[model samples]
Target: MRFKSLRKSNQVFIFAALLFAGLYYGAGLLVPLTFAVFFAALVLPVIYWLEKKTGIGKPFSSFLGTLLIFIGIGILLFFFVQQLGVFLQDIIESKDQIISYLRKVQLKAADVTGFSLQEQNKLLEESIMELLNMTQTYVSGILTGITGLVLNFLLVLILMFLVLLNRDKFEKFLMMYIKPERQEETKEVIQEARKVAYKYLWGRLQVMTILAALYLVLFTAYDLRHTGLLILFGALITIIPYIGPFISGTLPILFLIIFGGTVEEIISFTILIAIVQLIESYVLEPIIIGSEVEQSPLFIILAIILGGMLWGPAGFILFVPIFSMLKIVFDHTKGLEPVGYLLGNERPGSKENLMEKIKRKIGRKN
Candidate 1:
């Protein structure tokens, strides 16, 4: 029996590996669908509320919700373009300063490493030329693929609208496939998963908003060039988890250094970022996001890595909620509770065995 069980486990692992392979290779199609599903879930409450309040049908309400989301994205993109223009202008104006800073950095590096300045300059020029060639290739590829990218984006929007409109039908269809005895449990799992996803997405938006406001104030106070652009990009990039904030902070600091910021200014800004990160890690995340999904840190990190490997950036954004949904399903199912526990956050005193505690209570009664 033990051997048979082990064989079954191996089969399951093999199946999962195959599924992941498909996901990685089929990312072009799957990524947008994944995005649509998440988008549908995120805006579901708004759609329902609008339907209830306005007495409109689900189809109309879903369209309105999708439109609102599209408009919001459009506005953000508009501002991003404007800020990018300003950033480019600033870079152009500071070109000489940037070159001076680069030369100083090259010299400093040569001095520390005992390499001649000429050798250092030669290496730097080679690296820059390679980077420019890569950039040119990347730009051309993007130009060629722009049409398909737009079409895929539109398809995602359409899919999101359809999913929202037919959400009830989809739920019923899922229930129809399940055995009658398990239908209620399945429904409970579905509801729980939806609740977790909604809460997580909403909490993320709140966190991003607060962080952007803080960054804006801080950057403005420091008199940083292109403060608005930095804050927007930084806050959005922080959604990547872990290393994202460091990258975001480094970009602005590098820009400042290139454009003639003082050492004191650089040090002060770095210190300010550390302090803000402390507040975000300790206070804002706990209070605002809470423990809705309760995924273990190790598992979350693994998910981020796997997601990045499979779907690139979209995977990073989607994998946490995907894992959270899986956890909900595992928790609801009789045989998968162990898997759910493995994914869950560790809690103090939760290690006590429930059966042992029950036995102790019985002994006490005796």
Candidate 2:
């Protein structure tokens, strides 16, 4: 018995090490494939609907679904790119205004610090030159990599189409490993995972939309320039969670500072963003995303860190859903319930969090 237990532990450790090695080294191919898989999950129901309602063949329906996904993404990219251009143009046009604002700040700093205006001006010029140089380097890097990005995106689309078309084949392939008695459970796990992926992705989209709407109203009220650009950026960047929101908030404030918005506007915007973030964390996410995935906060953060280490930026967005799906599989598999529970948010003895309780009440009402 002891020998068997030791062998099992060794096997588990070897399997894990091999898995990590593959994930790290195979990222170039795996990242896009993983994205395609999740993207298929997100739109699988739509493909089903098209096939059922339109009485279309699977290939046509899959193609239609993939095309719709591409169109939706293309529209977003179009708006983002267009708005980005407008933002850069506005910045260029306001160069004189920005300089005037900077000069005022320089003078104020000189007065407070008992420094000469010329000295301050010299330092400011150097700082601005450094910033411009850094920006140029960043842009150059992006330009150099643009071809690879486009190719990867095309690969993802193709894979998404194929995955959608052959989903049943994939299901059959998975079932080949399971005993007939457990096949039903395996199917249930797959269905649950699909539902979780769809719900989480859709809920995130809804959150982004609501955030954009809120930002639109706030920016309009403050009479901020390039409101569309700011709103789009603020909404999209929050997809990465903590760091994303920080960048989203910081960029707008930086724009206001550079473009000469009043201090009152800046302060108010900061406070409102904090409030909005609070509401998003405590309210919108819990209600909209629900407890379906039941991922614990610690495990989610760990997953993000591990994913980032393994797969870079894409990992940040993909790992949460991946883990959620894994949790479903774990829970359904015999002897793995403990592992699933460990990944889960619920605790047997602990009281429910405020949001969870509220979610329970809302769910009951629904």
Candidate 3:
């Protein structure tokens, strides 16, 4: 019995290694395909609504849904571009001030470290050359990537439209692999997975929007420089989970530090951001996205790290939902319930907090 258990463990480890290897190697194709599927899932209801209400053909409905998504993306891009212009203009306007600040920083460093001006200038020159080389390399890569980006975008739209149109057929395809007795259970699990993905992504968007609004209002009232760009970045970066939020919150504080803000002003801004983040994490998320994914925090972090390793930035966004869907599959499969529970966010002995209780009440009402 012990030998059998050991053999099974080895098999599991081997399978996991193979799975990760396949994912990493196939990521170029799989990442965009995953995005396509996710977008298809989100827009499926709209397609259904269009078909049922307008008596439109499924193909036309799918096309319209995809077009709507394209328009939305275009709007966001336009907005970001406008804000980016403002950001660049601000920097250009403050160029002299920025230079003055940099000189002060350089002198302070020299004073503290007892380095001569010539040595410092030499070090600076070397650093600038290194940075220029890296910038050249990155620019070349970006030029190459532009073509791939366009092709991937087109692929995603086409795939999304195809998936939306043939969603039922895809369901049938999945059913073919299951025994007749288990097919119904598998179908339920698939539906739940789709629902989970849609809910999580939609909830994330709502959270980001609310956070952006809060940042905009506060930063504007505070008369912060480059408020538009800062607010836009702080909100959008929250989509990447833990590390994203940290960077988002730290950036404005760092900017203030570099630009010589009053101590009181920095402290106030820090407190305000902390409160906003608290509201987002403790209030908005629990109320909006509660139990939708239900995966443990540790598992989500691990998934993000593994995803970054496998698929770069896209993996950071995709892997959490992917793991959540896997948990649903595990929960419904025989002998895998324990694994599912392990991935879940349940605290076996803890009582629900006030925020959680409020979430429960709101969920019940909804």
Candidate 4:
């Protein structure tokens, strides 16, 4: 009996390990697919409301909603490219100003830090030349990237249509394996998953939009060059979590310093970024994320870190949903319920300091 039990335990462990590997590989391939599904969940209610109010069929409503998503994307892309073009033009126009600013900075740095202009100029020249070379190399890379993007876009569209067309069948398919006694629990998990996914995607979109718009207003107000482009970048990059903000913020600062803009303008841009991040973190984040996904604060931060460490930005975007699904599975299993509760997020503002926050996040159960 002991031998048999040990063998069974080993078999279970092996199966679980294999399952994890499969899931990780599958997730890498289906990040784009996951993105489409997340959006579909968000727009599902709208589709239903439209269908109910106007007598439209589900398929037709799905197509219309997909079209709306495409149209909004088209507009955002148009603005982004337009801004990029204008920013590049401004860069070229301000070439002389940039060189002058470099000379001033070089002089100031030498006075303060005892660096030599010749060395500074040599370093700067090498960097600029390297960037130019990199841009040329990126041309081919861009073509490949564009091809991948088009493929993913079509795939997302197809999935949205199929998911809508066979919604009832899909639900049945999901529940087919579960025992009759557990069907209700399975249904509840599915419902909760859908709600969390919807809240998350929509909340993220709304916050990103607000931050981007705020950037545009502040950049323009400060007379920063390429304000529109930087704003578009702000909107786009905030989708990537913590790292995105730093990058999008750096670009505008670069040209501001490059063009010898007033210290006032630079200061304004800095203040604006600091404020937007604060607002997003403290106000918008809690409001959108509050008690919804059932993820612990530590897990959420770990998701961001691991996503960044492993797969870069794509990981961060997909991390929360992936973990939420895992939590559902864990919740369903008898022995894993305690673990699931620990993996979930604790409420914020219930602590006085960082250590307290960590304790609350980690010490959820006795």
- List candidate 1 segments past 4 Å from native: 1-3, 85-93, 105-120, 123-149, 349-366
Model 1 lDDT tens row, 7-78: 999999999999999999999889988888887888988888887888998788889878977887667656
Q: How do all the candidates rank in terms of TM-score, highest first?
A: 2, 1, 3, 4
Who wins the TM-score comparison? 2
Give candidate 4 misplaced runs (Cα > 4 Å): 1-17, 23-29, 88-96, 132-144, 305-312, 348-366
Sorted on lDDT, best first, the list reads: 2, 3, 1, 4
Q: Candidate 1 has what TM-score?
A: 0.85
Which parts of model 2 have CA positions greater than 4 angstroms off?
1-7, 89-96, 113-124, 347-366
Best by lDDT: 2
Q: What are the per-model numbers of colliding residue pairs?
A: 0, 0, 0, 4
lDDT of each model, Cα atoms only? 0.80, 0.82, 0.81, 0.73
lDDT of 4 at 24: 64
lDDT minimum window of 10 residues, candidate 1: 349-358
TM-scores of the candidates are: 0.85, 0.88, 0.84, 0.83
Q: State, as a TM-score between 0 and 1, how close model 3 is to the true structure.
A: 0.84
Give per-residue lDDT, candidate 1, residue 349.
41
Which whole-number lDDT from 0 to 100 does residue 274 have in model 3?
Answer: 90
